[model samples]
Target: MRQDAGNRVPDRLTSLLLGGALLLLPALALAVSPEPKTFRDWMAGCDNRKSCAALSLPPLVADTTAYLRLERPAGPDSAASLILRLSGDWKTPPATVELKLDGTPFPAAGKAMPVTANDNIATLTFQPADTAALIDAARKATKLSIAAPGLLAEISLSGAVAALLWIDEQQSRLNTPSALIRKGSAGAAPAAPALPVITARPASGTLSEKGGKALAAALRKHIKQRDPDLCGDDASPAVADEAWPLDGKRSLVALTCSLGVYNASNAFWIVEGNAVTTAKPVNFPQNDGGATNMLTNGEFEPKTGRISYFAKGRGIGDCGVAGGYAWTGSSFVLTELSMMGECRGIGSDDWITLFRSEVKTAR
Candidate 1:
């Protein structure tokens, strides 16, 4: 997939949970705001003094990057404008100047504007029709780049300005309060304060071999309850893996459920979390002793980084299988399990595989 940086919205669920928390608790939310002492403010200050040339102009070079920052004031009828303070040496003063709004070429109407010799600064006033579309386009841009056909040097944008612009646009729609409330009535309940959202870190510490055996034992017990034939006297083609690094802080444990008869396997990794734990499972494709095929499905948990699933086998080689490791801090909890290696004279057949895994903090 072609990665479009601008089009990517950070994972939706993560955004929702984080955004909800911020909306509910503004004070504690991460705020993006512009600084009071900015280039725009400096320009305005200089203009008020009626001495534009007094401001020192920053140098601009050809094929170099440059840009201006802007923020629309909050409110519906706020005046829109694109203000750029140009600074650079002009080799050949072009007869006419052209402005591109949001990467779209704009039609030039006026003659070339003169740049002040002392300050090398020039301001281009955009018309109303141009301002609206420009403002709208700017609000959607995470990063803005500006260029003049033959200008050089680079410009740096302040994050603060970008943040302020975003805030202004976001608050614009809520400029007026609703008038549907009853006369002299108190408003609806106040919004809840936002809460801090934290993701659970993987567990640390060394996993006890004994504990791994015990977890596998517990899983086998659970599996037996569902299908008595699934667990035999010996470890039923299923093996367990664990990660317990020397740090002794976090760990991972997994149970491999393999269907030897059908040539398929599914491995489930149990992870640790602060409140609720999770599991990660991986599936593997099964090739017939040269005859059957296989398919599988699974689920993933973003917050805790876990996946889980079951596999079914059919058509000599048709079966579901998966296997993968869960990163548990210092070491990896690896697993490899599958089904469908043993097959006699072929015939279409079916088999069902079911399994589950859970995450719990180290006790």
Candidate 2:
């Protein structure tokens, strides 16, 4: 009887092991399948020196797209590198992993590699032969996959052919970088124009009419392409649409095309010392309603020098938020974002102070 009990233990363990192996069969089959319809756009480009690269996202379970870049050597002598820039909470455990490509067995595509990490970025280096194989598989295969123990990344090869061709042209400089690659001259691509320097406003005194006009002109010149898209063509016509005063004798200038209630866009510039720079809301709400949910109207408190704005809640009539900010020498820090949701009922409202430095001093 004791011998039978010992044999039963071994049989139970074998059954459990078999069940686990059966569960992994489907996942292994999926890893080799050719159908991959989840990947979005594939983008490839090169820098001025003809160093080319390609970036794309694998099939993601979430709505966001995290890019993984494969870069080739700039010239004939440079080394190859693969970069993965991660965001939010997506990451694999820090360990050495073997990457199998195109359904190949482990070490068939490449050896076991340790991924180096820097903050939110992970990098891996490769030889030229492996790099060429990667590009080739990207161009020809229907589905390119890289599998590790806990991570399985799959990218659709729909536009990879065009992307690889673009990379080739970028490296050879056959034609100026454009939408497509074609045979052309062999000279260097022309240098791109430099971005203008934005000056800061004076700290001691308010901007005079001439200073304000100069600063506004610089702002318009720098944001010409962006301004038209955001606020339309008539934004900041002749002069700035609105201007307000802030601490340190500075001014806040606003540019807008639509003054009506809905679908209106506005850009802001802050004048300090003798320069004007773009400024964003210190605390912008991240909600399903988008940018319109942020605090729109802003005003400076007379006695406290604190900046305040109107913050709307998430839904149509969920609540109203009163947001406040204080310039702390370095940045406009959020002081408070208080909400009052009970419109016609007797429910209690909620008030939360994000930063209390200015509030503590005021008290």
lDDT string, candidate 1, 1-363, tens digits: 011122111212111111112101011011211112223211111111111110111222233212342333323334434444443455643233455433444433422333332234445555566545444454443333344456533333224233333333233322233111111233322222222222223434445667656655555556556556533334654453232322343233344343344333333434342111232322222211121111122333333433333332233232223332233333222222222111211111211111112233232
Q: Per-residue alpha-carbon lDDT of model 2 for 247-363, expressed as tens digits?
A: 464665555433333122245556554454444422222322122212244554434545565423222222233455554434444454433322211011222111122253332
Cα TM-score per model: 0.25, 0.39
TM-score of 1: 0.25
Candidate 2 off by > 4 Å: 1-41, 45-53, 60-67, 71-81, 85-92, 105-109, 117-129, 167-172, 175-250, 254-266, 269-363
Error of 2 at 84 (Å): 3.8
Q: Which ten residues in a row have the lowest lDDT in candidate 2?
A: 22-31
RMSD of each: 21.4, 21.5
lDDT of candidate 2 vs native?
0.40
Assess each prediction's global lDDT (C-alpha) against the native.
0.31, 0.40
